[model samples]
Target: MTDSTPSLDLLLAGYVLNTLSQEEAALLEQYLAADPTLQERIDQLQATLEAAYATPEVKPPPQLRMAILAATEALPSQQTEALPSQQTEALPSQQTEALPSQQEAEPASWARRLPAWQLAFGLAAAIAIAWLGIDNYRLRLAKETAPTEIATETPASESLDYALQPVEADLTAAAQIELNPAELEGELTVAGLPPLPPEQVYVLWTILAPDAPFTADSKGAILTETFNTNAQGNVTESLVLPEAYQTLAQVAAIGITVESADAPQAHQGSPILLTDL
Candidate 1:
């Protein structure tokens, strides 16, 4: 209906096949009125089909002809022998009544007569399958309604709080650190601090005691995280602490300082905020 060339071609194919519905025929006629070249294409298609049909027919091989003939000859005898019982079933009511005793003497071959052992085995198998199905359904139902026990972990032990005192008295910027000794994890909350430029970030440092059984940088500090404060100059961050924090004596102190974002671990700056572990 939209006059698309492919759609018109499809309608033309259906027309050639004599398969187009009445509505499709009318639609194609509308297109044909607007496009006279479509008629030439139709004539070319019909001529090609006629040329193909004009090709002389070739006979099948003699052996194939013989095979088909042999199959046809044997079909009637097979049907007659296989369905003798069907003939009796089609008998008139008068004939059936007259030959009642004869019919009883010659039971229909189509009705299978299973042996006693076979019948018993089949019945036992059916019972077993039914029992298994019922048992499976009950098991599934029980699982659906059964209460489930979830293993809940004990809450993390209480954390120790340490206040980070600002070195510059005039600056009211301060922070608090909460360390979970057992879990070796902590949170740092900073307030009243000013945001740094993109190239600079705030870094947290954990300094260890001289004789502690843990590694540290040249300045005896273990760098934790490098972060930037938001426009409000406030940020809360979770950090993983060193194992030495479990024994407060092993950790000397924790601190925060401004550092180059490119190399925060270099520890080039001194602490502006410090907290004794």
Candidate 2:
């Protein structure tokens, strides 16, 4: 509370609204005590504030009237519960005392139901704030996980899948590969094949015909791509098809050969895995 007239008016407004904390109220009280004119202004402001709240223009929810009545009915019972019988009896008589001057609550409401209306508003405000906080938190969580959800639901429609046919029999060591023909891209997934030596890389070849003459020194047949197997003889690898074949499925046969990686373009080893497109 300041000594100036404008500050006094603001202090009176806060006092009328019952919004001041104990420390602030104490400061205002001290200021008011020294000036009789300020005390008169406070009384006037309080009357105006009460009138404003009571007017038809300031309509509270109809439930608020019910809350006011309920609060008035429960006041005596709440006062009894505020001092538990067992706790009151346990406290030594000498320690019991009136509320100290500094700890004093605001003066009792002149209009008893006015405080009830104020209490109902406070409870409604607290509930609204809590609901808003929870809603914002949930929205934030959804935003953070949005990318992962979209990725999980997305279908890989651009890629074409080809099931490899084993040349000799229905072998379990064969790998399934998916290809995107437009990009000349391939992903080979190998499982159950015995892991070969690191020096021998697995080479995939695309041949022009089933019985086509082929060799490292030969022309026409091309080595599509090469990769190594993992510790479990399982490997999933991405490969690019040769420029001669935009789609590897266009070729007659696909074969995997255990060969030295030093000669990527040549086939110097016997075929270990053979399949048709």
Q: Point to the candidate with the largest TM-score.
A: 1
What is the per-residue lDDT of model 1 for residues 26-122, given as tens digits with 9 covering 90 to 100?
7668778988788887887566455445534434356545654555565555545655467778999888777645323322221123333433433
| Model 2 spans with C-alpha error above 4 angstroms | 1-158, 165-171, 209-219, 247-250
Q: Estimate each model's TM-score.
A: 0.43, 0.36
Q: What shift in Å separates residue 65 of candidate 2 from its native position after superposition?
A: 92
Residues 184-213 of candidate 2: C-alpha lDDT, one tens digit per residue: 787888887777776778878766654444
Query: What lDDT does candidate 2 reach at residue 121?
Result: 53
lDDT (C-alpha, whole model) for all candidates: 0.71, 0.61
**Judged by lDDT against the true structure, how good is candidate 2?**
0.61
The TM-score, computed over Cα atoms with residue i paired to residue i, of candidate 1 is 0.43
